[model samples]
Target: MSELRFVVQLHRARRLHYDFRLEVGGVLVSWAVPKGPTLDPKVRRAAFKVGDHPMEYVAFEGVIPAGTYGGGDVIVWDTGAWVPYKDPDPGAALDAGELHVELFGEKLRGRFVMVRTRRDEWLLLKKRDEHAVAGWEPGEHPLSVLSGRSSDEVKADPEWEWRSELPAERAALRLKAEDERTRKAEDERTRKAEDERTRKAEDERTRKAEHANDTEHANKTDHTNKTEHANKTGHTNEAEHTNKAERSNARARKSADKHATTRERMGEGARASVHERGGADAGAPGPEREHTRADERERAAESAIGGLESLRNEAGLDAIGENGTWEVYGRRLRVTNLGKVLFPGRGDEEAVTKRELLRYTARIAPTVVPYLAGRALNLHRFPNGSHAPGFWQKALPAHAPQWLTRWREPGSGTEYLVADEPAALVWAANYGGLEWHPWTSTVDHPDRPSYALVDLDPGDGTAWEDLLVLARLHRTAFEHLGVEAGAKVTGQRGIQIWVPISRGPGFAETRAWVEGLSRSIGAVVPDLVSWAWEKAERGGRARLDFTQNAVNKTLVAPYSPRPAPGAPVSAPITWDELDDPALRPDAFTIRTIGERLSTHGDLFSPVLHTQQSLPPLT
Candidate 1:
């Protein structure tokens, strides 16, 4: 072999990991070792096979812009040549699910054995050799062999350019953003240092005043003693003693006043220093500082939604008129009845108007748009207040904008709106759309769905607590099937779970599979679940509605605000929250969803990316 090269890059990205690669077939066949390699022969490391990279990447070390693959810092930790120990060509052996190799890298020098455990999964074992150490850890030596720089150093330098995975323009924009963030942090540090300097100068001035006072007191004592020696020595002694006592008292008072002043200044400085932190009182003392930070965090959470809550003074803006043209995503939209209230005020939540609804939809577009994209949508419109009346709009209106994605049903020839972007969502919301329901399937393949559905609908007489138990059962069933699923509050009286899959099965097959899974789960706890089509027959149990997998059938899209009381939103929840006694389907409303999104970003985002398959039913 012509000097087969290998490289192990210590990647401190979104998470710390290592990219282990070997040059083969003019490309770098790579594997991701999360904890990095160890020399202990007894230790077998897990390696997940990833896509091949170009040979040019062997010397690559730099910062990857956020949102890109392995977006963070990278450093060439170790690199050298490798030779097949047992097989003539390592490539053939790698394909055969086992490979024996002798590494001659800067840090790693040993005979290693690699064996495949599953597709894209492998075990790398260090062969017992002279090079093997008992407790070899990766981070003990973090400097890159190529640049002698750590991953942290690489991330801090703008010159450590990002690779071309992102478009040049977008990448440049991201680089600019990074520069801005760095500049802001630097500015904050400078301000903090300046505050410290100011406080120190004040203290120095106070100290100087105290020194001056002490000098004056000493001079007075010296003059009094000289006068006593000159005349009336014995008579002046008692008077001199009284004067001395007065001088001592004056000095003590001055010192006390100066110290108190200094303490007050320091407290003020501490407050000033943390003013911009938004979630801390850095100047506080001991446990007070800790408690202040916690309080500030709670306040910060509230402040995050300040804009949402300040529904006051919303009327006076030409930015949005009762009826005016608004441009969104390069499309001009004419919105009417901007001040018309669609949802009445409930308790602490302010009444939601068409304008406010449009704003909320636009604000949340980035998080919600992915779920709506590529799918035909059904809008539930409430022109009047939600308490008054509402109706579902299935077919797209003829007057709908031409730019909007339109899909024609195969049989009825009725067209549906495919809201695949922010503008479309805002436009729909402006038209009295309260609840948005996107089909489980997309426009391209209406039959093959990428998500299997499970809607836990609480029937008559079912307590909210019972649904919680039933939801837990669903988690158990999903785990047993070895599929990843995401849960969400339906904003009404149900919980919706969506399992992202590698689409191959048609809607019929997917529906059947979900139904089977639901049936099995129901069988486990018959009292808590209902499979009965009739509402009264179920005796108030939560129904696992798997029928939503069919074509044209839809559930309220996540983050979609329901027209029910409190303007509740269909919000995403973590799987672990199912067992939480405090979990409530109605807790997340339009007023609070923003803060949740800010604190815990897109909890259900994995549903858009996780492509795990449910093992075939025997």
Candidate 2:
């Protein structure tokens, strides 16, 4: 058995290529690949085959001379034992233009095929299925690290060299070519440096010219001012004074002219100096700069016009056309007539009369739907005319109607049935329900149940101090009763307090509890607060609307539009904002409440699902 070892030195002539070598058949086979051997099965690297080296070359390691062809320190990137598969003849594989090998090294262990394309070119491919990892990319496979010498290391180490024993004729030609390449590279660097210097000099020249122009303008302004002062005064001595001033001015003008001339000369000299320094007009603005400025102005003008139009629309004095009339909570409302025209005809076509339309109007009112408490009903006529003709429409009743009915006390507790129309039902379901809002049901969200809502009438000229006192008193009463209470601005002249509790003992029980609490608090704070069942008449005290304690009564969600009381809404508020007398409900609305909720998930969320003991008010 014979042991074969050899080393072939390689130089990747390109600045970005890698040098590779391998020992085979008592000689070193070398290749120079721009991109090193890729373990990726898809990529075949073109490795140019250089001539071989004798077996003794395996121990050769040293620096090649600088300014010489392939001058650098040579380091062994990889050393390994290889088994070549081929015909018995030593040069048989080379002549056949094909080589097969299984390499085993410290870093690389794989089966590879090197097929010669020409006298000096070959292709290296990994037998991906046999030896490389399945689905491996070049850098992903650990075995690919065999091409470990990075490009940076090769460039940084000047002593690294590729020592090849080439024929004398080839060596001479390679040396001459390397020297020429070096000279050209140095020349290019010098040219770039000169160009940079020229640019700086030109900029200096422009600055000097601008400075001289500014001085000349100042001198001309001084002359014009003196002439104006002389003409302002009219007297016998004016002529004498003007003559003396003229002589002095003439001397000053001559002196100024001489200075101006000198400045012009200095500027010219500066320009000459710039030219001598090889400076060009590198400071001139490019076309892109002007386009950028124009774009900015156009955007500003567009923004201004949009803002003006928005302000005009918000002023709201536009044409008030008749939309239609809708009755809500027994109150008649005149809305846009568009709703009636759009209404889809339904039921036996008696052609709905105006009075019947009024009934429909009352039925679809925003407040009435909740009162229906989720009972399915047929919409014989639509106020909006959007529904299909004769289509049976069911009111979105309360998911838990029994709870709402029990809480409202339809006949006994409170006149919970304030209106019979669908509109009244919607309003009651939304504002007067066991769960407060129909959309948010205690049955659905046991974790964050809503509370009963009430609106109060704070009479005109009510002092902020008085309102605060009433709020504090009510808060005290709620705390004493062991109820979890929170307060907020009603977006109007009153304060709204929310009591959080679980749906225990049904809605009637809760309503009874709240009513008792409110009456007791009102009696205790009579000087500051009054519980008036009816609207106040003239200079009467502000009234605590006890009717709000009724079950199934809802406060609008923090941002819903309230057409009454000037389109205000029940807004979620910070404790600080609630304390401010100037803050109105208009500042809050359903549109703006989401942002606050995201930061603090419903301030009353914790008490919603909790049960509390309602102590009798002291």
Candidate 3:
């Protein structure tokens, strides 16, 4: 191009930064600079290449709605025209990591060099030519070149709405940092509310006690006055003893009643571990429980009664009832079809029932809920048992209990259930949902992935040893990329390597990074790592999958029960444990997970706590 446009926007976002853009290849190649550019060649400013912006934003200056990515006020700080120096193609030079340009604009003039030091990182330096000043600061020229107004002045104009087509990705670092702030704020609010309640309780108790004391005082005073009358009679001593005892008993009764009222007012939630009415469902306000077609038809009468209360009344009457109430998280779970076998026995071993699955789910809730909470779930339901054909449940049924969280995608009209509490997980188990696959992204940040997954899916002829080798190779790739990754036996054919990333990358960026990393790894070990999308073309090799990085795509959560035999779990493990000759995909089952988790705690805790960012690996 003969001459291209360039502009710099003073962005007053979560942080006050500057956005530098240059017209290249029909888009504005951009970089975010924390500190504005300096004319001194000695001072090299840091710039992060965010991405491209459409040409429509060349003169844009206004506020981006709050809660959106890059939600802030902006001003056209500078406007200019630029031409590449000597080089015919500026795009080719940028790709080569260096670009020399000459500016002929109202404010900026002379040659400047933009050098790429790392992916998404660059250094802008003044070339020490005719326009170079020894100690020039961008702050010296703060007014917008377009509107002749400062950024603050531009922001004050409320009617100027930003309609730029550049949709920025939500910054994950901001969310991660806010985690602490949000927690502290919530804790403070909770503390204050509890304090206020305690103050009220104390005041009520004091008032009641004072009233009782006043009554007791009045009775004692009356008894003293009667002493002189009783003295005239022969039964004076006996009468005095009886009168004092009666007063003491009356005082004791009043105190007991006072305490009972307080306890009643506090309720089960106020007093921790007080899951009252063990046989009665407390979450009646929640959505009605989901049931199979057979269940609905068979228990129309019970369904008419709403939920649980009818079953609770029958709890005392039946010796071996089909439905039973279990107290979980202060809610009475009226689990039905308790004797329904989900996992069949291989030999003399007894088959696993729905009752057993419910128990395990309640047992593992504390360990597994962290991974499931806040994420929209895709449940693998085996309602008729694992042997029967199962289906993946995305849209939550209308009858799903009100307590289970539901998310309706912004535009898609699709509703998804979220596992938020212990009761929620148990409810799913009762609904015959065996396998849990949670979205890679949480509900709060729907399009931003928290972790990048590398699913090692083996072909029909792939062996256990082959998987082991590939697992080691995965470890090498993680180390080479300088990222922290954890291994989990997928509870089936392969092992999954989970790389937790800090908040900043969108699904697109995350997917690109994962795909590039996997492809690079595949190149080194071509025979072992299959790149073919179709299974038939893989020729029995393990396929490295990065496609799971997309939004709504899910991987089985750690400690989740699989729909496979023996009720195996997707168990997280240390890398050293993978080398054990006896290690198999099905080694960790529900029977053994409770003890293992009890001993080791959560081995996958790092995946949630430790986050890293990898360089370009493709």
Best by lDDT: 1
- Per-residue CA lDDT of candidate 3, range 520-601, in tens? 7777778787665446657788788876776566789888888777788898776656556667887777777764554344
Per-residue C-alpha lDDT of model 1 across residues 1-618, encoded as one tens digit per residue = 334678899887778889999878878899999989877788989999999876656656667778877777777788665667688888789889998886756678668988999999999899876567777788887877644556777688634455566543223222345555676567556556444543455445546656776898979958867776856545576678768755634533343335224322112222333233331312224566545544543443443343322221122222444765554555656567889888888787678777777777766765677789988887888777688756566656535666888886542233678887778988788777788988788888876788888889899878888788788787766545445677898888889898777777766567668888888878887888776543655667777877566555678888999987778899887665665566678888787788575554555655665444555754
Higher-lDDT candidate of 1 and 2: 1
| Candidate 1 Cα outliers beyond 4 Å, as residue runs | 1-318
TM per prediction: 0.49, 0.29, 0.50
Q: Superposing every Cα of model 3 onto the true structure, what RMSD results?
A: 25.7
lDDT of 2: 0.41
Q: Of 2 and 3, which scores higher on TM-score?
A: 3
| Rank by TM-score (best first) | 3, 1, 2
- Model 3: lowest-lDDT 10 consecutive positions: 265-274
